[model samples]
Target: MTSRQRSAPASILQGVEALLRPLAVFRADLHRNPELSGQERRTAERLARWLGHAGCEVFTGVGGHGVVARLRNGEGPLVLLRAELDALPVREETGLSYASTVTAARPDGRVVPVAHACGHDIHMTCLAGTAELLAANRASWRGTVLLVGQPAEETLTGAAAMLDDGLYQRFGVPDVALAQHVAPLPAGVVAHAPPGEPLTAAGAELRIVIRGRGGHGGMPHLAVDPVVVAASVVLRLRAMAVQERRPGEHVVVTVGALHAGERANVIPDSAVLEAIVRAPSLAAVDRVVEVARRVVEDECLAARCPDPPEFTVVTRVPAGISDPVAAARVRRAHLAVFGAGRVVEVPQGQASEDFPLFGADGRVPTVYWYVGSVPPAVWDRAPGAGPLEKLHSLPAAHSPKFSPDPVATLRAGITALAAGALAWLGTGPLGNGEIMSFGSLP
Candidate 1:
C-alpha cells in the first residue's frame, strides 16, 4: 500500500470517533420514529436537514420521499452513496431503549406496527456520517458525492421510482454507485462477494387469492374450505426447494402472510396468500413462479373450489451484481481501512435488494458490500462451533428481535463507506492514476 493509503485510516478513524456520539443519537431517533414504505415524509425531512447542515445541495421528493444530497468538490469522478429510508411492518421486540413504539396504517387501511428490523436506520446513519466526513475533509478527496435516501425499499420499488423520476439525468450519472447493508456477522467486520458473483438474489412477490363457498358452521357438507387448499399449496411450495431444485441450485419460497377467516366457526368465502420467491437469476425466479402458480392451481382444483385462484405479481427485481473493477477497488480500500483480519469474502446471499436498479442495468458501474452488526460478545457466546452455524442461530434481518450493536457497527460502517468514496475520488491510498482508470470503463 502507498504511504498515502496507509495514512488515510488514521484520519478516517479520527473523524469517525468525533462523530460517533451524535450519529448514535441520530440513529436512535430514527429507530424510535420509523416510517413504512412509500410514507417517509418525516424521515425525508430529517435527512434533508442533516444533509443541508453538512453543506450539500439537498433535493427532496424526487420519487416519493427520496432525498438526494449533492456535495461537489472541484472536478473529479462523481460517486453516489445510497441508503434506504423506509422501515418494515414489524413490532420492535429488542427491548432496547430506542426501540420503536410506532404504528401506522397501510394504504389498504390495515393498521400495523412499524420498526427498522432491517437495519435501514444503521444504513442511513452511516451514509449521513460518511457525507459529513467527506464534507469536512474535502482536501482528502476531489469529486462530487451524491447521498441518496431512498424510500419503499422493502417493497422493492424505491430504486426504480427514483430512476424513473430522472435521478441520473437530474444529478448526473455517477462514475460509480456505492452502498452497504448490515448483516448478522460479528461487529467491526466487513465482507464482500467474489468478483463475478451476485451480491443478492433476484426476487418477486406473489399475491394469490383462493376462492371458496362460505356456509354456516353447523352445515359441514355445504362449504368448500379454501383454508385447506391454501395449507396444501403452502406445503407443496415448500417441498419444491428439495424436490424440484437442481443439485447445486438455490431457491427459496416463503409464505409470509395468509388471511382466511375471521372466526373459527364461520368459513370465509375466500383466502389470501402473500409469498416471496428468490433465486440467483431472473430465469430461475421465473421458473419458481411458474411452479408456484401450478401448485396453487392444482391444490384449488383438487379442493373443488368455486373459482380458479387469482395470481398477481406485485414486484420483481433483478439480482444485484457488482462491477468487477469497482468492487476490487472498494475491497482494497476496505482492506486498507480495516486490516486483512477484519475484511473477508462471503458467498452470494439469499436476501434480495433493489440497489442494483440504481446501476441502470449495468449502464453504470456499482459496488455493494456488507457490514457486520452483531456484537462481538453476543456472537462469541452464541451456540455454534463456527461462523456459519452461529450465523443461523442469531436473529437475522426482518426479525423483530434483530438489533445491531450501535457503537461498533456505526464506527466500522462510517469508515468503510468513507474509505470507499475516497478510493474512487482519487484521494486515498487506493487513489492515484490506477484507480482513476475506472472512469473510462465501458
Candidate 2:
C-alpha cells in the first residue's frame, strides 16, 4: 500500500466515529417510518436533504422515487455507491425503541405493515454518512462520488427503472460502481466473495395462475380444484431443489405467495402463485423455470382443467459478479481500514440482488460486498459455535426480527465505503496528513 493510503486509516475511523450519533438517529427515524417499493417519496426526500447538506449535487425522482447525488472533487475516477430506499411488507418485531409502527396499502388496497427488515435503512444511512465523510475529507481523495438511493429493490425492479430513466446518460457513466449489503454476521466485519464466484445469485420472479373448474364445497368430484393443483406444483418445485440440483450447484425455489378462494364454501376457478427461482447462473434459473412450468402444466392436465394456466415472467436479474481488479483494490482498502481479520472471504450467497444491472451488462466494473451487522455481544450469545451456525441462528434479512447493530454497522459501513472509494480515487494532497475536521453532522 502507498504511504498516503496507509496514513488514512486512523482518520477514516475517527471521522466515521464522529458521524455515528446523528447517523444512528437518521437510521432509526427511517426504521420507524419505512416505505414500501415505489412509495419512497418521504425516504427520497430525506436522503436528498442529507446528501445536499453534505455538499452533493442532489437529484431527486430520477427513476420512480430514485435519488442520485453527485460530488465532484476535481474528477479522477467516477465511483458510484448505491443504497436501497424501499422496505419490505413485514411488521417490525424487534421491539427496539424505534421499531416501525407504520402501515401502508398495497396496490391491491390490502394494508400491510412496513418495516426495514432488509437493512436498507442501514444502507442509506451508511451511504449518506460516507458522502458526508468524503465531502469532509475532500482533500484526501480526488474523484466524483455518485450516490444512488435506489427504490423498489425488494421487488428487484429499482435498478432497471433507474437505468431506463437514463441514470448513466444523465449523469456520466461511472468508472466503478460499488455497493454493499448488511448481513447478520458479527458487526464491524465485512465479507467479499472469492475471485470468479458470483457475489449473489441470478434469479427470476414469476407469477403463475393455475386454472380449474369452480363448484360448491359440498361437491367432491364435480370441480377440478386449482388449489390442489397449486399445492402439487409447490411440492414438485420444492423437490426440484434436490432432484435437479447438480453436484456443487446451488439453487433456491420458493413459493413466496399464494392466493385462492376467499370463502370456504366455494372452489376458486384459479389459484395465483407468486414464486421466485434463484440459481448461480441464468441458465440454471431458466432450467428451473422450465421445470416449474412443466410441473404446473402436468398438474393441470392431471386435474383435467378446462383452460391452460397463465405463466408470466415478471422480471429477471443477472447474477452480481464483481470485477476482479476492482474487487481486489476495494478488498485491499477494506483490509487497511478494518484490518485483515475483519475483512474475510465468503462463498457466493443464494440471496439475489439487482445491483448488477448498474454494470450495464458487463460494460462497467461493479464491486459488491457484505457488511456484518450483528453486534459483538449478540453474536457471542447466539446459539452457535461457528460463523455459519451463528449466521443461521440469527434473524436474517426479510425477517420481522431482523435488527442490525445500528452504531457498529453504520460506523463500519461508512468507513468501508469511504476507503473503497478512496482506493479508486487515489490519495490527494492531504491524504497522507493528519485527520481533517469533519465539521458537524446534519
Candidate 3:
C-alpha cells in the first residue's frame, strides 16, 4: 500500500490486496506460536508492536493480555473492530509446516497442546491488516478506529473482562462495533445471517460433580457408584434436548468431558462432568440449565448418593445478533467489493462468541459476520465428488484438521473489514462527500 492519500474506492481495494503477503506472513507466525486463553502475552505483544508501528496509539495489557489500538483522523463516527487473540487447547494435526507445537500450563497445573483451531489467528491478522490499511489510507475515511485484541475468547471471558476493566471508559464509546469470523465457506466469499436469524447462540458451561462412596472396583455393590450416576446424567441430558425442549426451538447439549475412576481396581470418590449448552436465546439457555440441574440431581438421588450433585456454571456468552442496519450496510459493502456472486446467505450458527459483549450491555450497535475460508479448488471439487463431499467436508473451525488457505482467506477477510469500515466511515478528501455504489468505491 501507499502512504499517499488516495480516496478512490479502487485505490482502497488495491491497497487491501497489496497487504495480503505481509498479512499471511504475520498470520503464519501466530499459527506457529499459539497461546491459550487468559495467557496471550506473546500474542498481544505482537499485535501491540504491529499496531504501534502502524501509527496507532496502542495500549497494552488492558484487561488481561488485551491490546487496544486507536487511530483518530478528524471527526466522524467511532468504529471499533474486535478480534480474538487466544488459541484453543486442541493439538494441531493438520501437518502444515507452520502448525503449532506449543503448549501452555493451565490453572490446574497441567500442560496441553495449543493451536488456532478456531481461526483467531486469521481474525488477528485481518484486524492488523485493516488497521494498517486504514492508517495508510487516511484520506479516504474520517473517524476513530479502535482495534481490539481480546484474549480468552475460547473461554468467553475476554469481552467481559475488557468491559469490566473499562474498555469504553478508557478508550471511547463506539458508535458501531464490527467483527468477522473465518468459517468453512468457499474462499473469497462472505456470508451473513439476516435479521431474526443470528450468527451464534448464547452458550453456557456447566460443571457438575456427583459425590459417592468409594470402594474396590470389585465391590461395586458395597459402595455407591457415582460413575453410574454420571452416565445416567449424560443420557438424560441428551434426552432433555431431544424430548423435552419445545418443538421448532433448537438447542444442543454436549457432554464434552466426563471423569471418574483412575484405576481399574479402585472406584473414585466422586465423578465429574463438564457440559456445554447452547441455545438461540437466553431464556432457552436457562431452560436447558434448569432441565440439566433437575436431571442430575434426580439421578444422584436415584443412585443413593450421600451428597447432592453440585452444579456450577463456569461462563455464559450472550447470543451474537448483528444489527439489522449494520448487517445490511456491511453486506452491501461486501457485495461492492466481491460482487453479488461472492456474497452468500448463511444459516444461523450454533457456535458462540463474546463479541456481543462489546455492545456494552446493548449500548452499542454491533455487526458480526463471517468470511469463507475454504480454498477455491477444494470447494469446486467437493460438488463433483458427491453431496456428502461438500464444503461441509472441509475441516471446520475447532477441529484438529482445521487449516485455512492463507492467501485466499486473508484477502477475503481484509477486504471485508476494510470495506465494512469504509461503508460506515464514508470516504472523503478530509472534508467532501463521497458516494458508494454497490460496486464502485468512489
TM for candidate 3 is 0.92
Q: CA lDDT, every prediction? A: 0.88, 0.87, 0.84
Encode model 3's per-residue lDDT on 1-442: one tens digit a residue: 2334333544776887778888888999999999999999999999999999999999988889999999999999899999999998899999999999998897766688999999999999999999988888787778899999999988888999999999999988998899999988778877777664788998898989999999998989999998888999999999888775687678999998887887988988999898989988888998889888999989999889999989998888888888887777777777767777677666677898889888747788899888878887877766534423475567889999998888999988988888888776765112222222212200
Clash tally for model 3: 0
Q: In candidate 3, how many Å is residue 155 off?
A: 1.0
The number of the candidate with the highest lDDT is 1
lDDT per residue, candidate 2, 231-285, as tens digits? 9989998998778888878989999989899899999998999999999899989
1 or 3, greater by lDDT: 1
lDDT of 1 by residue, 1-442 (tens): 4677567655755789989999999999999999999999999999899999999999999889999999999999999999999999999999999899999998868899999999999999999999899888777778899999999999999999999999999999999999999999889888888778897999999999999999877775799988878899899999986666766778999999998888889988999999999998888899899989999999989889989999988888888889999898898887767777777777888899999888856678989999999999898898877677788899999999999999999999999988888887866545222221111211
TM-score of 2: 0.94
RMSD of candidate 3 to the true fold? 4.6
**Model 3 Cα shift for residue 61 (angstroms):** 1.8
lDDT of 3: 0.84
